[model samples]
Target: MANQSKIKVCVAGATGWAGSELAKAIAVSGELELVAAISRQHAGKSLNEVLDIAGTKIPVFATIEEALTVPCDVLVEYTKPGVAKHHILTAIAKGVNVVVGTSGLSDEDYEEIGIKAAAHQQSVLAVGNFAISVVLLNKFAEMAARYMSNWEIIDYASAGKIDAPSGSARELAYRLSQVKKQELQVSMEHTQGVKETRGADINGTRVHSLRLPGFVISLEAIFGMPDEKLTLKHEAGNSSKPYVTGAFLAIKKVGSFTGLKRGLDSVID
Candidate 1:
């Protein structure tokens, strides 16, 4: 890519752990440029000060409205669920494409966003987990759903994670439900134990979430058969590098779309 053709990007939540990594990755990449960094807590500080990018003078703004004053090709959001919907809609209204890395948003949320993006002639790409392995995991689970009669999703995250079921697990359950209806050994209505013990019902699949210390983020899709069991799991490390490449790919491809697209697999050929 030519220097003049680089994609100018504004990053919301630039001071956060994942956001900082994304900012640095954009700054160092020849295909992308960090034009603005948004963080209410770090407002008035230079990107160099907040992100420690020596000599770079990108300004940090307290709000998306202020950040939009700068020219940008894309807005990469890594904020919380509470604000992600507004941020994405604001960007679309401003004629900017978006790549959303935030979790906890429901399918209804994306449906509304897609409508807005289509009306505005912009694009929004939201991914539950950007790791390539996780994308493959989802694909494999979809394939397994066709053959297996019973399966459940288990999502593991750190205690600090607020969402009950991790986004990855939700995405997997949704996709699997579309492919096959889970055959439960015991129906929820007939179960004797506490209903909560059966886990949350997503579509037709049971999704169990676990939050505890010493766990980063992980997910498992377990399938049960008459004589054997199959388990597919993916565990993420503490670092955020696994997400960077996938995010960059989303940024590059989002322009080709007219509305919201979910999952990294959407961009993978």
Candidate 2:
């Protein structure tokens, strides 16, 4: 791609584990340019000092407001839920497209963001899990939902992760809900066990979340029939490479959309 066609990107959580990886990815990509790196903790530092990327001189900003002033075409946010929501809305208001990798946003949250993006005629692509395999896992789970009525979700993450029922699990539940209703052995209201023991009831699917020290990010969709069971699972490694490619894809395609687009599948096509 030519320099004029290169997409200018600002990374919101630029000093974070995932955010730093995204910054490096954009810095080295021919189709993208790293315009600003935003992190409150590392504000006023050069990208080289913050991210350790040699030879690059991108300045770090303390907040999205300061970063947006640099004229960016896209904002890729990998911050916490509260911060990510604010950054996304602000980016849209400025007519800058967004690619969201941060999880924990509810479906209703995305709906409101969609309205804002549409009003500003900007694009926002919000994805729970950006690994291509995870996208396929959700697709396969949706297909299984049509044939199998009984299913549950399991989301696994490190103990440090803040969100419960991981965003991937929530997105999976929503997708499965759209395809078919889960078969219930008993009504949730009349269940014998403690209400909390039933896990989270997300769109009729029981989603169980597990947070432990030894786990990275993983999700499983287990489908059960009269005499058979099928489990679809995807596990991430220690690296963030799995998410980088998908993020880049979103950055490249987000400008084509005018409202919020959920899931990597939207951009996959």
Candidate 3:
């Protein structure tokens, strides 16, 4: 109800590829305020000066700790996986809800963060990718897994992305595992050639991660049955715009719950 009653938000990695776009959108939203930004490269400068966006004099801090001093209602974590967990925990420790837009966070990281969020009575909504198409892909794929006896996931991302088997792939694998067990793959001991070629087994699903130059981010689920097969795919272009709306959605819904929830599907109706 303060500062024109906008939902105050702090964006970490506010100058990065996706974060910058999300921050710009937040600046123009009447219901949200871009209160503080965290970007080490643009530290000590006002977001208005760094991003050249008018009407936003938000300060850019080098660390989440410095940024959280502004007392935001939500902390949007868009930084790298290495520092993302720390930033999220820092915000939760301050009793602020979090919407995670970062990637490459391991399963262990989410477990640790979930515990911290619960102890602080805070909520953390971590979405692998905010693209609406990608969100729907998980749902559609889950349905396919229920009927198909065999399936595999192929995850593609830019070569610079260090995470193997991306968050999207992990999410799909987890969902399919919940529906049924993977009962169709050959045993590693009985494999003919190299067993490593089978791709990493993720919760009963074979998940293969490809790091190539042309891909921004893409995911495909291939389902197979007798004399028939189906493939579901989702791809994103070079722009980060597809992610803003969903990240904004997370900011709106994170305060509605406590502890960690993966994907927008968890909170979306």
Candidate 4:
């Protein structure tokens, strides 16, 4: 086994919110070394220039091929969902493990990635929501599902977020569905007159999405009983530190995992 201190990393989407923060985290983390960064728009800029972190002047490349020139053991993907799949696939094909944070990627996308990972003997891990509190929210939802059957998820993100029923919400619905005994209310059917008024329905659970400017990422798992309601909520503020820590954990752990692993909880103890 290689020494832990020698692990090298590449950060894709180095200029974006999560990517830049993750790059900064990698720069500060003593266990891992930042070897490359990829961002089409930010190419030619140094890592220090793009992330505002001094000392390392690693050249940024606009394409993955260019960035791959740098020696790296893992790739941390923070690009959009569509872009992320390609990056992860490419990394795995080249024997580089991946820790993906971009949302909106579907199960089919992951299944394909799994095939590639198994063929190459590389690791691929995807996280819908990286915030530790959000991780706990999913954990608690799984536990709550065992006792309750009537539940719905409300997923909230900024207005600019393109995906409907945000990844976290979909994951929660999927996890809850695994344990939920009774089917949930189908709220979409009753609101036929106004389609926008209704949110996306998952299995039997109705997942309502709120896209507004002030919100970062937030979710509420509402469970109902004969007369009472239980709400498990997780709110993420503007800070990217929480997500960065989780991303770091995922990147560090992916290599040890032999195949495709889904969700941040898989890596978390």
Give the top-scoring candidate (TM-score).
Answer: 2
Residues 224-267, candidate 2, lDDT per residue (tens digit)? 99889999999999998788988888889898878988888987
Best by lDDT: 3
C-alpha RMSD between model 1 and the true structure: 1.4
- In the range 44-109, model 4's lDDT, one tens digit per residue, is 979897677876677899887889888799988888876888888888878899888878887678
* lDDT (10s digit) by residue, model 3, range 204-246: 7889999998898999999999899999999999899999989
User: Candidate 1, 251: how far from true, in Å?
Assistant: 0.9
Q: Total clashing residue pairs per candidate? A: 0, 0, 0, 0
- Residue ranges of candidate 2 with Cα displaced over 4 Å: none
Instruction: Please list the C-alpha lDDT of all candidates, in the order they appear.
Output: 0.89, 0.89, 0.90, 0.82
Question: Relative to the unseen true structure, what is the C-alpha lDDT of residue 107 in candidate 4, on a scale of 0 to 100?
Answer: 67
lDDT by residue for model 1 over 72-185, one digit each (tens)? 999998998889899999999999999989888888888899999999999999888888999999988888888888999899999999987887887888888789676677
Count of backbone collisions within predicted model 3 = 0
- As a whole number from 0 to 100, the lDDT of residue 63 in candidate 4 is 82
**Model 1: CA > 4 A from native:** none
Candidate 4 residue spans exceeding 4 A from truth: 1-4, 180-182, 185-198
Candidate 1: residue pairs that collide: none
Candidate 2 lDDT at 239 equals 94
Q: What does the lDDT read for residue 199 in candidate 1?
A: 96
